[model samples]
Target: MLERFIAITADFSIIIPFIYLLFKGKIPLTISDKLIYVYIVLTLIRNIASFVTMMLGVYNIYLYNWYNLLSFGIIAALYFQILNNLYFKMLVIAALILLIAIAFIDYRTLLNVRTTEFNRFSFNASGCFTILFILFFLYELIRKLQVKKLTEYPLFWFSSGALLYYSGTIFPYIFIQYTFNNLANRDLYWIIDAVLSIVLSVFLCFSIRHMKHQKTV
Candidate 1:
């Protein structure tokens, strides 16, 4: 019960920034900003869909997994915009492939009543997104070459958040996948994911704030 409470708190906290952005006067149109907006909208829709499914007791987690894939896609796009380098185009391609794979897996869930096979596919597909996610930051750190570049732009926070999150999640997620054991301690790992979400959302909100300030200056 406490974990659920904490999860709700963390989830709602992350949603606050998107809520603020949605109601703010005009939407941001820069490639990065628009992508964030789309991500935010998709997150909201996914949550709503989740709630409906849960109320119906449908037991479908793939819906939420697809949401995660889309979120990762947006993150990859955001990173590319920040780095704005030709080499990052490869990362974009990887992100697209990840997205397509997840979509195909998700579509299978609807076609077949049995979800276990689809769940397995969804699980690995989400992992693939995480792999791409970790690669994006690794590439960023390697190719950027200038430490000062991390500080010069607003998207830096998004990049840093990704780094922190990718670090926190990659091991646990992979471990669970390989072990294939339904350990009793599984819920504990959600704390890592939740913390990352809260941290990333706060950083993203500040980054947007910084960008807004720059526009007026």
Candidate 2:
């Protein structure tokens, strides 16, 4: 109960900044801005689903896996742009397609209504690819060019949130079979994810608001 409260609070932490964006009706013309806007909507929908799923003791496994895949895919594409080199854009697109194909192949299994299990294949594959792409993105950010004040860049903050949150959760997803059956372990996983989410929400808020000042200027 307490952990759920913590998680909900952490999740809603972005609402203020999101509402600000809604009212202002403007943001810096950047991929990061678009991604954050979509993310805000998705988070709201996911939270509602989470509430319903919790009370009913039913899991929407399809939404869970697909949302992960979609979120990672979007961020992956955004990072490619942020890296400012379209050299491997074709390869990235191919990889994303393959990721989708892989998920589709396992759709029936993943969507099994009777089984109270998650589709680790989609979850871990998406995580691994996203993490790899992000690592390369970071390398590019540092090596290809040196921006004077990267800290102010929205992508910098967005990537920080994604990198930190995903890195922490991806490993657990890889080894999910070990802890999925244990109530206490599952709760621990939720708590860890929730804490990371708090960090991410803060960074996301900053990522969006940094533009408000730019808007004024």
Candidate 3:
């Protein structure tokens, strides 16, 4: 089915790049670098968890809550470093606290679910991150324009990736929750996630190129 194909593609699309990046000698090993490594590892783990749950024919269960916490945490850590100003740090902290509360709610919900009829867990995970990504997107775009830093390219690319992801993933996810019995449900989720993965991969590739140019200079 389309769902399975998308899942397999995402598995390879994301896992391969992270593995390559982790081992590449040319990649800088800075704080952002290490946080990125952790992010990718968490991504892989979440994917594996979803794959396992799917293979078991479960409908709503996933590893998204925990792994996504790590992903957002890593992102916040890097953003904190990038901004470095107290005002930005406070904003990031506010976002982090809100996300942590959502994650905790998700964790509690996961403990109580025992059905194959709904996939609210996925919605909660994707939707929460979608909003977070938007916040990050705005912050990155505004910060880049403010500083006039050449490194803005990476921020811009990242913001674009986040924008695409939210548009492709979050919209459908929010609506899909209302229709649990629809057989067309899974495809919607898969399609959005696939798009998100592809968009982010493109951004990461461009970021690597920019980093290489900086190194050469």
The numbered model that scores best in TM-score is 2
- Local accuracy by lDDT, each model: 0.60, 0.69, 0.59
lDDT tens digits by residue: candidate 3, 98-118 = 766655554554454543333
Better of 1 and 3 by TM-score: 3
Question: Which of the two candidates, 2 or 3, achieves a greater TM-score against the reference?
Answer: 2
Q: Please give, for residues 1-217, the per-residue lDDT of candidate 1 as tens digits.
A: 8887766665666577676775566744567667766766776677666667767988555665556666777766666565555766676767577667755754765455434323334444455565565566556665665444455445555556656766666666566544322436556876777777678677767655544422100
- RMSD to native, candidate 2: 3.5
* Residue lDDT tens for model 2, 173-207: 78766654354577777777788878888887777
Who wins the lDDT comparison? 2
Per model, how many backbone clashes are there? 0, 0, 0
Worst 10 residues of 1 by lDDT: 208-217
The per-residue C-alpha lDDT of model 3 at residue 56 equals 88
Which regions in candidate 1 have their CA more than 4 angstroms from the true location?
A: 98-152, 178-185, 213-217
Model 2 lDDT, full chain set: 0.69
Show model 2 residue runs off by greater than 4 Å.
109-115, 181-184, 212-217
User: Model 3 clash pairs?
Assistant: none
